[model samples]
Target: MSKIRKKKIKKTNILLGFICILLAVLLGFILVTSYKSEQKESRHLSEIADDQQSGIEDYEAVKERAKELEEISSEEAEDTEDTKDTEKTDTADTEDADKTEDTKDKTTAASGIVCWGDDLINGEESNTYSYMTVLQKLLTDNGYNMTVINKTLQGGGTLSMMKMAGVSDETIQSYITKHQQAANGAQLNVTETGIRDLTEEQTTRNDMDCIPVIFMGYYGGWNHDPAELADQQEQILNTFQNKNQFIVVGTRPMDGSVTSEALDQVLSQKWGEHYISLADVTAQPSSTYEAQQAMAEAILQKLQELNYISKN
Candidate 1:
């Protein structure tokens, strides 16, 4: 009887130890699975956070862009008024006006540089007010008869818009590459979709055929691929045939989005002598008008070097 009892007790002890071991193994497996699941969830949450941050940045950009557009519109209204006044004066003073018109016609018939750009170069807001005025001053001062046609204060700078307006794919591609490389091998954040808009809008203008050179510049709010940009540059060069006659001047990430690389590369290629760093423009940190004058001086110097002025 004693032996039987001892054997039963031993059996019970063995059974309990086996049960404990099984439970421990099951518990470890559950813990590991739970830990893995938690890790996956954490990673997913991190991605969501990153996307949210990007969305916020894009939202801010859009808002800023809207503000810029409103300002530009007001300035444009003022310009229209000024233009109307000038037209009235010209009509009243026909003799003098005719002489001026004739001279301008003659100059156009002779030779001149046609300049153009997107909002960064032609915005209506105070922050962007001086681009054209500065450019015009530079051209006139340097003796080049210049005609500027500003298009698309809001939606005129994308590649798709350019294609719709008749700018060649080759031209668009060339512009992108040139801009990216000009920005110094830095990955241009501009997307391919909007790349051709500015070109198309510019080409569609009635004045497009008249301008010899296209001046294109932009700031932030878009992503332009560097590889695509280089290809576009090559295409433009091939299409234009005459660099001296149909030169394309471009400044990338014009809204302070791009580093100096884009500007540096562009200047090094076509308008190296003509290139002026934004620093030069804002040397004294003066009013928008004063800074524009400074920019004008640099551009004027380039025009002079180009021999646009008559010797008369």
Candidate 2:
């Protein structure tokens, strides 16, 4: 009876020990599974944080690039504006210069003939009445209105006769007879008028008003002494001054027979470069068409330099 009881108790103890071992094994498995799940969750949280950080960096970089682009656009706009302003300023300056030139030309034209000279060159021969005719042609070619007064007198080159207020009886008789013959008695009742009876001032004024007046005459040569040439120049200047007109004097060349260095010297001293000698003025054949063309060209050049035309 004692052996059986002892055997049963031993078996019971062993069974209880086996049960405790099984429970311990189950608890260990549960703890390991829970630990692994928690580790996975932590890793996921770390990955999410890293992604957020990358996104923030990208956003900041984009903002910086946008600011840079804005600055570039603003600078481009300013450059465009500056370019336009410069162009406008240049245009204004050009216009101002053109206006100034126009004003100067108008003033000169309104002042009448400020300067005049004889033949542009020395040692030149010209028809007395045709001198102004050539000048008129030249002026007209150069876009100026030019008409010449036709006057017939004994000395075509001298202004003395034209300036004189008195005429001889013989000259008056000759004029009347010539007119009577030209009429051929067709107008027998035609009245005979004496030159002395004519109004000098009124006739002179009428002649001056009839055509374009040019102060051109032959002087300063063997025909006239230095004193005479100087006197003539002075007289013409004085006369034209009173009338407010331009005068032209013809000078003899130093190389010509009547070459008086004195006249040139005086002219150079008093007139500066305004005087022109017949030699230079009529170097080309005086009677030739080519000479006429050359003379016209020279005069046109002078007018252009004096700002007579619109500036290019």
Candidate 3:
């Protein structure tokens, strides 16, 4: 055959072998790169899954805590005949109440007042003289045994106040939750008043047979819609299990001046003598201890005038 032909064939074979090796190396590098990419992507997805799981756990825990804070107990029903007719026979009804609200009644079944309000009514934890507290003290000092059960907290707006007052209506709760500003004392900023001793008596929830004094309207405008807030306040009054004499106390609006004025007028008209305004008691109602004293005096005066308590 031919030596040159054999050598040429051998050279072609060598070239083909080199090409095969190069292709194998390139394929291995591509597979290694693909494996590394898959690993990186898997790790990223796992991290995201873990973070989402943690967030869900935190959210569930917060929901549980909120449920606890909003729990309301059913109060024992009392002979609330005196509370049923607050305005119909104002002079006569309260005259009868006076007999039961005096010293003898104190020794028998102590008088109670369930107060529903905001920071102004609850005051701060540091000051023990919330309007309800001071009003209770004033009544006790004046020969009457009165217990004011403060159902309120700081930043507690009308909606949250209603929730804490045993209101479980879904539509109402949803409306408030969506509308109220978180920064204000609307929801989640709840703190309950501990059982306290007033003079010789320990105060208990008197909702079963007690006067409910509602002093709301602290959060508005930037905090919440003043009109909606007023509506919520009205709704709160209806949540009472007993149809009792409920006092509606109004506050000076924090913001939304125009709507606030309108709200004030509407409240006054609807409630009539059953309503009281903080503006009438103080130039500017506040959470201050002094303001609370003024508030107490105002409430005491109202009770005396209404014959809810003995003028003597």
Best candidate per TM-score, number?
3
Model 2: worst 10 consecutive residues (lDDT sum): 206-215
* Preferred candidate (TM-score higher): 1 or 3: 3
lDDT of 3 by residue, 1-312 (tens): 699999999999999999999999999999999999999999999999999999999999999887766552212122245455555589777777886566344423424667776765332553577787778788888887667776765664454565555555584446645544443553432222111122212123346456677777665421344455556666766765434456777776554443435656877777778777776677744667777788878887776665555433
Q: Which portions of model 3 show Cα errors greater than 4 Å?
A: 1-110, 121-126, 177-206, 221-227, 241-244, 256-260, 310-312
State each model's C-alpha RMSD to the native: 33.9, 20.5, 28.9
Ordering by lDDT? 3, 1, 2
Top candidate when judged by lDDT against the true structure: 3
> Measured by TM-score, how close is model 3 to the native structure?
0.51
- TM-scores for all predictions: 0.41, 0.37, 0.51
lDDT (CA) per prediction: 0.53, 0.48, 0.63
Any runs in candidate 1 off by more than 4 Å, and if so which?
1-111, 121-129, 137-146, 151-165, 169-191, 195-214, 220-242, 246-257, 261-263, 266-271, 274-276, 279-291
Clashing pairs in 3: 155-185
Residue 158 CA error for candidate 2 (Å)? 3.3
Angstrom error of the Cα, residue 95, model 1: value is 45
lDDT of 3 at 218: 69
| lDDT for 91 (candidate 3) | 75
Error of 2 at 62 (Å): 88
